[model samples]
Target: MIAGHGPLRRLKDGTAELHQEAELHVRILDADATLTDYRRYLAAMFGYHAPLEDALAGHEGLRRAGFDPARRRKSPLLVADLRALGEDPGALPPCVAVPPVTTLPRALGVAYVLEGATLGGRYILAKLPPQLAPLRGRATAFLAGYGAQTGACWRAFAAVVERVLVTPEAEAEAVAGARETFARLIDWLAAQTRAAGAALREAS
Candidate 1:
């Protein structure tokens, strides 16, 4: 347990279970996962991130808290990877069931899940199947987010989270938002009727 009454600690500890569950539900690293599965993963991710980031953009709290959301965007990376794989990202449907980041606390919580993925991107990149070797640089951009700067980026985000979510109410909102992001993302990826439908469902 991260022993602290601080909102960041609470948010991290509170979402630990859901975090693990989300990992289990995410299939990009599965041993048998193939190139098609990778394409679907990006598509599903694009579906989720496209809408979520749109919600976070221009939020005053992010600027006040010293967080730069533009630098943290993953949707573009997903699009580039998809295009490299010979898919038209614009043709894919974006997820509409995205969590609402209506407030600073909620936005922070939602961003927590999205920003955290950069850290795991290294692991995901390393575990990518040999089949992806042909599309190496192009297909792996999303997973190679921030590359060597991932650690610094996470620390900066942590600072913003801890600085902004100082009150109990803010903590509650942030935690709830984080948990919802985790749950909804899993649902968005797992639901068989969305952009990634068949491949993501198979991945799950």
Candidate 2:
């Protein structure tokens, strides 16, 4: 149980390294990446988010914290992106398991990882090639999920997390959940990248 100044701060500080590693694996930052790169990235996102969102669905902790599971789902956007890119949703690989969220503190921790990605998506969206403009709204919906309301949505989530994680022990649990989620995402992305590379080699 690592203690910190605040729950959110602790989660961020604790997961900073894992966050950076995940960002490095994200395709949006690759300058030489092509449309194919984006497609694979979206597919990977779909694989990672679909299962996690399912687990979070109708979670009592989320509802009590004023977090609507429906609006927060990113898998649909990932699916739409895959479709817009001419990929079959059914062909995508299965998502990895997410950390269990039986408690409010743990739920908030997992939600934190998902919601926080929206903020980073803003940056990813901006760096997208000009040729990708047409897909911005449709294929890139996951990145631009909240649009201008992104900041507001994050603030609202933060408020709920703060309310739910009142004690030090609760905060530690939240941080642990967040860390586990981040690690899982990193592993999933690495596996996706490896699979993509193997496929490319087979094609060549």
Candidate 3:
């Protein structure tokens, strides 16, 4: 199953155990990608790889602790294809912010960075459920943050995700850290979202 369109979900049942472990191994493989091209692809979609690997490791740790999320099988062909694409000399730039930039080239950059991927890779790894669904604070944060700082929306988005998914006791810390890291951008995005709302009402 698809996890709200961002990544593939693991299948449960007889396939769960093996498939779950397979994804972990694949994740580790990507985490250790030796190619510069792969690293660049990672940077484009996600802000950085180290944090992403951390997040993935966290989830794997959770699973080891007996969390029962669905399992996803790895495809060798898919991995080879990704490896090949990463190695391609003419591969596109990873990702670009949308709406704020809105340039055709930049928009295309976003698409290229996200294209042909079944999973969020590092991007979704740093995320919580709300970022991908239920339209939480992250969306609010993104429009509020924008260009003032790069990847602010993503950071707030990830934080809000952690808040909702993590226990309430930890929510404030998560939000605060996210706010600190992506401060300028998240503030701008929030402002933009508000402005857009006002514009929509004026048009109406």
Candidate 4:
């Protein structure tokens, strides 16, 4: 159901429950989500992605595996979206509890989560309600993600995983990275959301 075959399918299948649980945390796609809700979601995500990407930088294995980390950099896009929505990306706290990406296979595993998000981002953008519709071209670059290139980008990433992770050991490490990425993101968002809610209540 997660699509793809070989390592790609393995990664997706392994992390399926964690993926579903993350959606429960990311309420932006809900029918009642408001503009504020969307803003909060992007802000929380920036907090997660900024540090994760920073840690992921300089990992030569990603390049050797045929995927340039630079091409898939997501923090810049998140920053743009946050700026458009009137938030200062610089002031936001980045997640310190990031997944370990010290190895090539582990990095690819971490990447699997980030790259897969683009596919889900399209679905959210398409089904977004009118309340969340105004973000379209301006504040949704993070979600808009490669626009028409998302499919090809994901396919390319999947291929890289398949080709690079030919051994069972490498695939296992990738799965570990994927699971850890999901776990860290879910925890970070949960914490950020609680803090945001408390600040809002205090303001009122």
Candidate 5:
């Protein structure tokens, strides 16, 4: 239903349900969320993104597909935000493992999820409470990564994805990869939420 090139259209349609489920689990729209909640959210994000970015680093297929790993990496930004929030990055729990993205199409699929989140990040940043407003671009670097250029960056990545996923088989692979990424991310965030709740109970 999403109007776009073949691969992107397939990705949007195939992963729509999974994407909605993941967003619900992440609870980005919870207006009553506090600074502590935001910290936990960043931690969850770091855990999800670190491993995936590591796998995509220096990937030959991504480079050949015209995707730039440097411009797209957000794991470091998550770590920085955690540190800025006075949480030690090394003290956070390990990130969940992502499925292997061995081919260009698969990488593009994963990239689609990661890059698409940044679009929504702008809205998330805007919704932060006044007490947490100062952390916008610093402690929330991952969300505000591109600052004003976020839309342009997404458009550029879309162009590359459309170019790389040319064949029918490639488009299918991209959709499969995006669906798998969304599923794993939902599981990981749910686990993190449970862990945080348990910790809160113990402290009280």
Candidate 6:
């Protein structure tokens, strides 16, 4: 896991490019000032780089497969495209088409552990540890709300992923897990949007 400013640099190469793209949404969450400061506090307490290099290298591999790093630079939403399994950013594996909100947070929370492993190797060893569950829970809540908000504005999210991350490849297990999490959140938001639309129709 290479850490630094900007999108997954590892996608520049072929091997990890797709996986790199799929995880782009997490980048947006990381960029939030509040979240960044919070993560920094934890990372610092344990000694962490603002940006890790290994993860970036992994992202570069994905870029080589078809992800456009330049697009990711435009905005965080563009980073979402990197998560698609194929050219169609909207397409998703059956396993991830419907994600439960309850399970979403735990999955989203796993990102820190995954990122740490990718970046530090034995340097970091494991996750934030069970002791940090409070922080992790907070992150999960933030992610849930953020996803709902983002999904309500999904065209933007889709645009970002389609432009930069969509590629012709199998949605690997890791990619599948991320997609499942994202799909669940987006689907839930889409439902809420539709319900709101229905209420507006009744008033009209």
lDDT of 5 by residue, 8-112 (tens): 778889998997898788654476667887888889888878778878875877876677876688888888888888889887776656767788888888888
Per-prediction TM-score: 0.88, 0.92, 0.23, 0.95, 0.91, 0.24
**Local accuracy of candidate 2 as per-residue lDDT tens digits, 122-201:** 88898887656557777888989788999898888887877889998898888889998998888888888899899889
In Å, residue 202's CA in model 6 sits off its true spot by 0.8
Once model 3 is optimally superposed onto the true structure by TM-score, how far is the C-alpha of residue 42 displaced, in angstroms? 4.3
Instruction: Give the least accurate 10-residue stretch of model 4, judged by summed lDDT.
Output: 1-10
Indicate the TM-score of model 4: 0.95
Q: Which residue ranges in model 6 land beyond 4 Å of their true spot? A: 1-171
Q: What is the alpha-carbon lDDT for the whole of candidate 4?
A: 0.87
Specify the highest-lDDT model's number: 4
Q: Which candidate number maximizes TM-score?
A: 4
Q: How accurate is candidate 6 locally (lDDT)?
A: 0.31
For each candidate, the alpha-carbon lDDT, in order, equals 0.82, 0.83, 0.30, 0.87, 0.81, 0.31
Which ranges in model 3 have alpha carbons more than 4 Å from their true place?
Answer: 1-43, 55-61, 64-82, 86-168, 177-204
Error of 3 at 202 (Å): 48
Instruction: Per model, state how many residue pairs clash.
Output: 0, 0, 19, 0, 0, 39
Q: Higher TM-score: candidate 1 or 4?
A: 4
Report the lDDT tens digits of candidate 1 across residue range 25-133. 6676776777877887888889899988888876777877898787678898999999988999999888899998789889999998898778777777877766665
| Better model by TM-score: candidate 3 vs candidate 4 | 4
* Candidate 6 per-residue lDDT over residues 1-204, each given as its tens digit: 232312222222222443344443222234232433333223221211112112222354334534332332211221232222112223312222332222222222212223322332222212344443344433332222233333333333333333443343321322444444334434443444365458779999
Candidate 6, run of 10 with poorest lDDT: 45-54
Q: Return the clash pairs for model 5, or none.
A: none
Candidates arranged by TM-score, highest first: 4, 2, 5, 1, 6, 3
After superposing candidate 2 on the true structure, give the runs of residues whose Cα lies further than 4 Å from its correct spot. 1-5, 130-134
